[model samples]
Target: MNKIVQIDPDQVEDVGPLYAARKKVYPQKVSGTFRRIKWGLMAFCLGIYYFLPFVRWNRGLAAPDQAVLIDLPNSRFYFFFIELWPQEVYYFTGLLILAAITLFLMNSVGGRIWCGYLCPQTVWTDLFYAVERLVEGDRRERMKKDASAHRWTLERISEFVLKHSIWLMIAWWTGGAWVLYFTDAPTLVKELVTFQAPAIAYIWIAILTATTYLLAGFMREQVCVYMCPWPRIQAALTDEWALNVTYRYDRGEKRMSVKKANDLRALGQHAGDCVDCYQCVAVCPVGIDIRNGPQLDCIQCGLCIDACDNVMKKINRPTRLIGYDNDINIQRRIEGKAPIYRIVRPRTIIYAALIALVGGIMLYTLATRSLLDINVLHDRNPVAVKLSDGSIRNAYTVRFLNKRGFDRVVAIDIDGPQDAKLHVVGGDSITPDRPMIVLGRDGTTELRVLVTAPSDRNPEKSIPVKFRVTDIGLGEVASATDNFVAP
Candidate 1:
């Protein structure tokens, strides 16, 4: 037997709506250890991104001299000394695998370090913030200016114009730098400056310029918070052992003003180090309070740590009221136990091992990769033809690749069907037994080939045929197989 239960409508739980309004963040400027580190990393990353394409490499007369190039017209990719053809796209797969594992390893060690210190979004946003700080002012001034109803003063208007102009210049250059990787950087620059570059280049520059301006200038932290998937992915990837930007709530609780804390300390009562100052929140790019515990919006950028350290110093209190720490350590501290770190734990070890294995395999394969390759496609329309002398013949389209740097004579041979003879459509055989053609260095050659065998000696229907191309000088051999059919 079951009893019926009734509830009042007024007692029902009310779930909140899904969406929230956006809040504009005006982060203050602060200087300390993390700020200096961010400055160094920003310089390094931006310098490399803008200038690397201009670097030159000496790859003989036949190849482009750019150190890094994506030769779309020629279907080639050149990175320093390594040249990859379209057929070798697996190298890119290996590279992506390596990148993913490295990111996982980074997340395991330190939460969102990539997002905080090294992400393009963070770097460019930081740069844009610096520009804003330069043109307008620090937190207090900017906040005041924004709050004022009449902010359209001449000085403010001029500052805004100047700031946006600089931003546009930087964004345009960023876009211009991208197109340089596809061609010779110096030549592209010259053409671009003279307004004589390809229309496509200008179109790409416009697109990237708009995106850079909008993302770095306007969107800023929104990109990391709402747009990028990495934040959500890293949230799932993070473990208790990973260090992140954290507030030491254990030391920071029982918050009060500095005067109140000093008086309580003088009275010999429990007084936490936090002065309830909002410095940590003030310097945050994402405008979230660290004291509210870990939030998905926090990028673990460590700027708040710098801000809190500065505040602690000014107040003559201990530093690191906010710092890089893990929840396990925080819990251990609360439990009156020493914190233990296990950077070499199982997950890290596994990720490291896999990275090593994949990296080693890629390196080994690259070192031992063949310099020559061949492909043979047997004709299908007329699979086999009856020749004048009663010999059964099969036609094939053979493609040869010469990965070397100089021209060479390559000999082609056929293996299948008894007493089969090979003939290249336009070539005279170097020897009566094999046909030979000249292969250009670092290029591909396609040619039609015919194979004939005595009709009386032909197999029932089809016989497996192998096409062998040999570099006559280097003695290197490459082979492909197809079926030789009887007419």
Candidate 2:
């Protein structure tokens, strides 16, 4: 049996509405180990992003001098000495697989480490927050200024202008740097400075600049909390053994003032280490309280850990009130057992093995990839024609690609039918069976080819024909297959 008491909308009104306005958070800065790590990672990531385009790679005189390029106009991708054609898009597939497995490995060891530290959104937002703090002061002062008339003063306005100008400059530079990766960096730089760069380049720069500015400068934490899907996906992927930035309530509960706790200890009464300082809450970039456990809103930035550690040091208590600890260790500590970490568990091992295996295959294939290729398309409409001399004729369209930087002499050959003679409509066959052609480096040649065979040996429906392309100088080879049809 169930019981229903009463309906009372007015009664709940005195207790206030279900929802209330959210309070803005102003995070204070603290220097600690995690803070230092964030700084180092930020430098490495930003340095690579901003300056890597200037790095050079040599591909001899036949290729673009730039070390890295996307060469969209030419339908090629160049990475230093390595060049990839459209047919090799499978390399991107292998790379994506490696990336996914790497993410899994990272999550197996530490939950959402990518989200907290390395994600573009997080990194950019962290940088923006640093700028904000420098211009507006830390938590308390910023809050006071926001609540007071001082927010509109000339000094504050000047700071706002200076900060945004710098932000726009960084955003523009980021967009400009992206364009360099698509073309010769030195040449692009010269063209861009002279306002003679392609119109598409300017258009892309403007779009990226606006997006970066709005996302990092204004949208900020909103992107992490509501826009990205990784938080939810990572939550599902994480295990209980994974180390996450967490508040150790076992050591930090039953909050009280430091003086009260000291007096309590003197009286032989048990007391927690926390002084209820709210330092952890104050330093959060996404404005989540660590004491509440793992919530989606928490970016796991470790600022809270640093804040709590600072408090612990000042109060002469043990540190790591908030630290990277797993639930298994937390439970073990509660049960009076020493905590243990297992970073090399079965899942981590499997992820590592798969990454190494796939990466090795990709590397090997890339190193030994051939520089020439061919494709053949048999005429589908007519299929085959009856020759006047009691022979069968088949037509084919053949395409030859020479990936080298200069022109090359190539010989084409076909083998399938006996007494079949090959002829290129506007080209030449070296022998009655082999066709010789010239292919331009980094270019393609198309030929209309005809094959005639004595009707006796030809198969009734279709028979396989292999078109082989042989590079004369390098002895490199590529081939494609099609079928010769007969009525």
Candidate 3:
């Protein structure tokens, strides 16, 4: 891969204002099985994200007590049972790949499940809606209250204040919870309250707070419809067989009043189950009519299913005119054939296999990962130096990471040269010149070393030399190889 070195690693410019003005989104409050599931997931996700950093796991006396931590200062990631240094960043890359693949799999089977349920935007937006309903009222009441002005009497003022205050409180808490993941949570909380936290911490809190409030409280459904890219990609990825919150227009259409439909059915004319109550549209958070034939704006949250079911129950008709279904299945039903569902289609199978492969690889690697790490850099500019006695020498910068919680002795040696002398600067060369080096607990140390080969021992013009680091305490060995150049 040709690296875009000029691209700033942390900077991606926002696509400039595509729309002249932001459209207001007043997501109607919904109650149904899907809404309840969304609420449960929201609470669970937020609970874990906000409080997990406070949970502790002991890793002897050397590691941080936090269960999950991203220590930017020390360049370490600590989970409940795993500690990762900079060298282990590849594991994170692997995880991201797995996560992306899982998202694709979810899209193939169910269509943007992440967007509908697990995405932070959706969760937070749902939370904001709940708060709004509690403080103000349901959709009709809220819309009515907004329409009238002096209706913003003292009571309205109090309710509005209470609502915004709660929204901001949640936003603030969300921001506060985020910073806890980076440091010791209990101590950081105290420091933050006393205003002793770092400037960067405060800056990050402000950024998160503003974003959470705006995105969840103000932007709401517009974020899903316009701001998020998933809907557009989901539209592209979806097929005829993928189950989505679909309106079975085959049954729901020829729409008319219950009395009118009953009259037509009695007369032996075409009639359908729908009562034309518009409950389905009213309950939709995204506010798109599923009867409009699966528009991009529909989140498929399944609130319509609940509303239609309720309507069906009240009117003594069949439920689920709008349900989790697919075009192919609808066609089959229309043709008087049994509807078929293939959850194990090629797309879904590929995605599941990839997920399994990546998950297995990650599990295996995590189970058997080495506790020690080593890195080597050969000195440049003067690749080789001719010693006084005519032995050719190469200098190397060696770094060793001791992941264990106790100090240990390590023996550094060279393996490729038959008569080469190894010197660990500031180290003991005792008992057959076994260069002794010490590593601190859960820390890294760098040392300069000189490897010299006698003129007669130079096997080739450029000989590959293997540098071996062996932990005396555990017999664990790691090696790096580089070419030794001859003058």
lDDT of 2 by residue, 284-333 (tens): 88788889898998878788889999999999999998899987888888
TM-score of 3: 0.92
lDDT per residue as tens, model 3, 1-487: 8876687756988787877465444556655777788878888999899889889889888678888999988898998888888888889999999988988888888886788889898888888888998999888888888889568699899998999999999999999899898889999999999999999889999999999999998878888887888889888888877889888888877889989998998999988887788888887777767788878877777778888887888888887888888999888888989989988999999989999999999899988887777888999969998889988999999888898888888888787876888888765544447787778889999988888888787857788889888888799888889888877
For model 1, what is the C-alpha lDDT against the true structure? 0.90
| Candidate 1: tens digits of C-alpha lDDT, residues 66-137 | 999999998999999999999999999999999999999999998888988999999988999999999999
| Cα TM-score per model | 0.94, 0.92, 0.92
Highest TM-score: which candidate? 1
**Which whole-number lDDT from 0 to 100 does residue 14 have in model 2?**
77
Q: TM-score for model 2?
A: 0.92
Q: Residue 35's C-alpha lDDT in candidate 1?
A: 94
Question: Which candidate wins on lDDT?
Answer: 1
Which residue pairs collide, candidate 2?
none
Residue 69 of model 3 has an lDDT of 95
For candidate 1, the C-alpha RMSD (Å) to the true structure equals 3.7
